[model samples]
Target: MSPRVRGEEQPGFFEVLGTWLPRQPWFRAPRGRLSLTRVGGLRLPTPAGDSDSRVFLELHIFEVAHQDGPVRISVPVALRSRPSAIAGKSAFIGKLTSPEHGELWVYDGAGDRAFLAAWIEMSRREQGSRNGRSRGRAHAGFAFGSPWTLELRRTGADAPKEGVTRSIVRREHADSQGEHDRDEIVMDLLRRPAGEQDELLESLITLSEANCEVIPKVLGTIDGAWKQKDDADDAGYWVSGILGVIREAGISGPDGTSIMRRALQAGDDLSDSARAAGRAVGTFHADLAGSFGAHPQTQEQLRIMTANVQSTLTQQWEQVRSEFDDDEAADLNEVIDLMRMQLRDADEPLMLQQIHGDLGAEHLHRTAGDAWVIREPEGLMSHALGLRDVVTVLISAADAVMSVAAETPEILRAAAEQEAAEAEQEGQSDAPAEPVNFGQWYEEFTQAFLSGYRESDADSAGVDSVFFRAAMLTEALDLFRRWRGQWVFRPSMLLQVDN
Candidate 1:
């Protein structure tokens, strides 16, 4: 049905829209139909030289549900004078048949490369402002952030557009071509009109593939990518390649053992096995920080983010503080302080470098050879606090190990294998299996790994012992968090000590 064109409101040209906005993938609404707050006549922006007034119509859409609930995105629509004859095939935005206006089309101008390109190119010049700004050499690194963040009335943050169409980065010495090609696609997905769910789903799959690739090659190995196939498409990528032989030994994915776990599991607690694992993470942090420091962000940015982080921690702490006895609260407080102090101390003013931003046990990878690895820096904050990465990863990993350390090696291994298999069955994946206690089996594993990390010319060791203790504490606590219900913390740590 064609959308209705009002007879009295005739303005040389007419554009038609429908109530079908809520179903779009790009629509950030949890559920709802679009209500036209204002539908204005199109204002042409072009080289028409004041001759042709064929302006594109604009629709400012407010977020709403199917006549109910709330949506996360602000909908603004600028539709062409008439649905382009070619609108039906557009990938990001598409055509809609309207009863009032005929077979018209809708396009998210922001998603259109023509519309997004200029904004991105322009933003390339604005590197952030900050002090103690890393004076050493650094790569321009990545420039990215959450494009379409949800805001509620309580926070008073304005409802944002559904998504960012694209982000641009200009390096220390480079042209303004966007650094990450995949990001534009991601931003396009962000800025897409909510109507196209299929594009969103496809974009998500591509994003997952990118995360899988970021794993360090030592952990991922040449075969790692191949082993990481549970989905049919991923399986195809692996099998079609001649290197598919890697998948035969093990699987990969969330369902399977990750390279980090594999690397950690391969060792017995021979001397420095644990420390070797630390090196993997530390080295990753170092590289990430170095790359980021070269392109510093202003302190104001960190100040804003740290406030958000503090609010989250304070809320969590208050709940736990009330529940805990003195000793437990103290312990919790101590760990929490380790995390909080970084933000608090930075108040005086500090340098801004990139961090893994989202680090955890899952992101830490291991290989079959007892090679501890850090990976999947998903929240790879180019402008972030470096310590946050270390703190969060350690805390998260500790939470994991604390719970699982008590189980017998065999039981744990069997469970891991089963979980890996189940993940594969459900299209989840783990990593290639090596000796669960690789430290004992291979005497040189720890030494060799540390040697490689220490010898690397790319980075140097600058982490303070305080972070090491925090790392250890977090590692230990992870065990506690996991084992808290099944077994007492002491029993597990005392018994099935992780090598």
Candidate 2:
């Protein structure tokens, strides 16, 4: 058995790395050991109810992803005791047979309750459907139905214990656990390898000194590490009641929708709402640059992650190539090669600035027209071109809105069959017809999403990054095909042959 890095002398945090990590869409590593460290945090528990650990237990597991690379994710885990029998695919992270009723798996009790309630109320309050928001009322609740990983698990009406302090601020811990050092380590973990901490601190200080209100104000770091020049906001890391703000935003009305609404059957109302949302994103990014400085990466810095990107693409591609076919594979390879060249040429100022690695209609707190700002709590994740985030978000939204007329795997077979049939038609060999442009579906789907992203002149070229990222995606799909014993074009065929 592999030796455990932790959980011996200290309280057990769970092996989640093995059983849980791979299943997460956000987890990058195929498998890597997770080391718990103190980033920065707070403990907010209401003094009401049983204090029995079940009815009232909210531990905000503020975690920072420390896997190799620049991707830093904020994982806020809420654990609450609940009635038993909620077992299924998740199996509740783990189970326990309490002396009370029966077996109970540690589950998300504060799931979306506070967060969603706040969000819903805020949305409704801002727009009462008169503006065509509210998912038309019928679909409003439906939109919130599926569990989004980004959202906490508290879904039902389960209320927080009364008298619980609304929220308390936390401070950065002196202990080096991932918890305490999250903010500091995030920059170290994900920022430019050669980037100095002093520079980041200076930029942050500049923002703090500016006292920017339109931008997200740093509430002081968990530690005094990010202290402002004015020394005005630092309260030694205490939690504040984000609840009222969250709730007000929720019922505020239809703030935004996916830009690819047409494909998803979203009407003008939602699309308009989404555009309004996009404006917020634009403002947020602008504010970030203003606060953090328009500083771009030096050429010397590019070399650092270039190798990492290449390696990640190569490795992940081998695993998922079955997800695409011969023509698709060839096309993806060609696009990636072209894109790399373009990126190398355009590897100029804008590509390197601090930007959100992931953005979506879901990520926004509220509409720009209303009151919304970047969730800096997510921290800055190291990423490729600025275009990467817009493309990814559009693709993801498209995936959400898409009806999935053809099964993804079936599309692969159709791609291969089409190639064989086309060759036969040209007097090479005879085979059945393949689905007409099996990948056209995904292409069209992603393009519809691109509509919103491309609307901004600054973001159109990012479509190219999607093509390169798709190369890694294609390779991984191919690997999946190999595993399934279903097959397609050889990797060589996808590569250009030397004359």
Candidate 3:
């Protein structure tokens, strides 16, 4: 075994990481030099059979402490004896000579196909055991479940005996994990430790399995460094979640946002898909409420949620308020005022329940089976008014319309500016016209979605005009934050609300 002591000449791992980490987009660039510590981490083994036995894949997480606060960064490294063997040039970190392993060439582990395959195998088998050894004092445990890896592997082996060929062909894609079939497993290594919030995914997965088909089957989750922090020594890499990869079941389709954009551009009817998506969302929300149950919103809880939303809006608006003109700013103020008023008084106590927190056409996939499957739930994912989901989706729809509308004017303005410059010589000029009839499909899309919700027999008690107006206004504030300086698009459809 390698020396269990961390500082014992481990080829200056921390020094190499400090040099390579800031270049990564996900790792926030510190204001000053970063102070890194190898708190703890876990590893996924290479597949059972491989051509090269020397290659090793490990995810080393660090607690990057800056003046602001301590943030975690997980680095997946591919350790090889031959540095030249790693193909990707950008994946190369610095080479080092470990006392135990010797002359190790390290590259970003995410680039390795073997690393990806190992994670997929773990998820497929649902192997949640702490069988692997931790390099340091950290005691990391791997927990698997949902479909269970054994079940997935058995599905492959038992196919012939069942007189059927598993139609889901293996078509691998690149990301954290590598190869995947039409339907496979994906493993996401969370940068931070698993907290109470992490439980939301597993809860939703279990509840949705019984109530609806909206979510992909959760394969399993692996909790790293599962122990109470006795002191600074107890800190370690905390948690990682893995799940079954939802495959495209639809005959052919684009992402939810792209479809909306196409429908707007072509003036194509999106009523059917819109309605279906809305229904899917409504059913999912209903299932969440039914399976997990909800509580009546206390006055204190309402106040806290309202304050949090208000504070966020204030912060984002401060950054972008200069972009709006007098009239536009006033209009935005009215919206904020409306939101404040709505939150101040409620006709009845709102029903609080768990929801998919993040909702939009983009986060949804139309499967080959023509059913809508949701992916990527953001925020607490635990309990809140179901209307929060409704509000977020509505905002996303609005943002999509804004993005399409914003594109045309930008194109025309550039053309007009070019023409005006040439016309200056000829003493003739024409300004580009502003886009009219903005958000043309807004009403249709909103109605279709709501109609689906109503059709799903979801309780309407929590939904009211006042609540909806407040939701819209709040979402508008969220969007307004992006309108600063040069009107850069803040793809709301792609943004996950962080609570």
lDDT of 3 by residue, 1-499 (tens): 3423232136677778789878765567678777876655666655655455677767665666777667656566766667544335666887877767777767775545555555445544544446442321100111321222212211121121111111222223323222223234333444444335446555645653564566654433444443234357765344433211222233123568887777665446677887888887778777777888878878777677667756666666566657666775676666666566766665466788878777766777665444676765544467677777777877787787667765755655665576668778778765543333444357667778778777775665655545665556546655656533223223222222222
| TM-score, per-candidate, Cα-based | 0.37, 0.37, 0.59
| Candidate 3 lDDT | 0.56
Q: Rate the local accuracy (lDDT) of all candidates.
A: 0.36, 0.36, 0.56
Indicate which candidate wins on TM-score: 3
**Residues 1-499, model 2: lDDT tens digits:** 2221111122333454235544544445423565443322222222222222432222222233454433322232333345333223342444444343343334332231332222332222332222221111111122233221222222122122221112211122323322231111111111111112434333433443455332333222211111112234645332221111111112122212333333233112234434544444555455455555554556776565555555566565556644665776677577557645654455543354566776654454452345443333234644345655554444444333332222434544655667777887798765554333323433443444345444543433434553345443444344334434333323222221112
Error (Å) of candidate 2 at residue 159 is 9.5
In terms of lDDT, model 1 sits at 0.36
Clashes of each: 59, 68, 14
Q: What would the per-residue lDDT of candidate 1 be over residues 283-387, giving only the tens digit for each residue? A: 554555443343443677647756766666566456435444577567668766766786566544434555567666565544444455453432356654455
Please give the RMSD to the true structure for each candidate, in Å: 18.0, 17.7, 11.9
The lowest-lDDT stretch of 10 consecutive residues in candidate 2 is 185-194
What stretches of model 1 exceed 4 Å from their correct place? 1-18, 24-35, 38-103, 109-358, 361-388, 394-435, 438-467, 484-499
Per-residue lDDT for 30 in model 2?
27
What is the RMSD, in Å, between candidate 2 and the native fold over all Cα?
17.7
Q: How many backbone overlaps does candidate 3 show?
A: 14
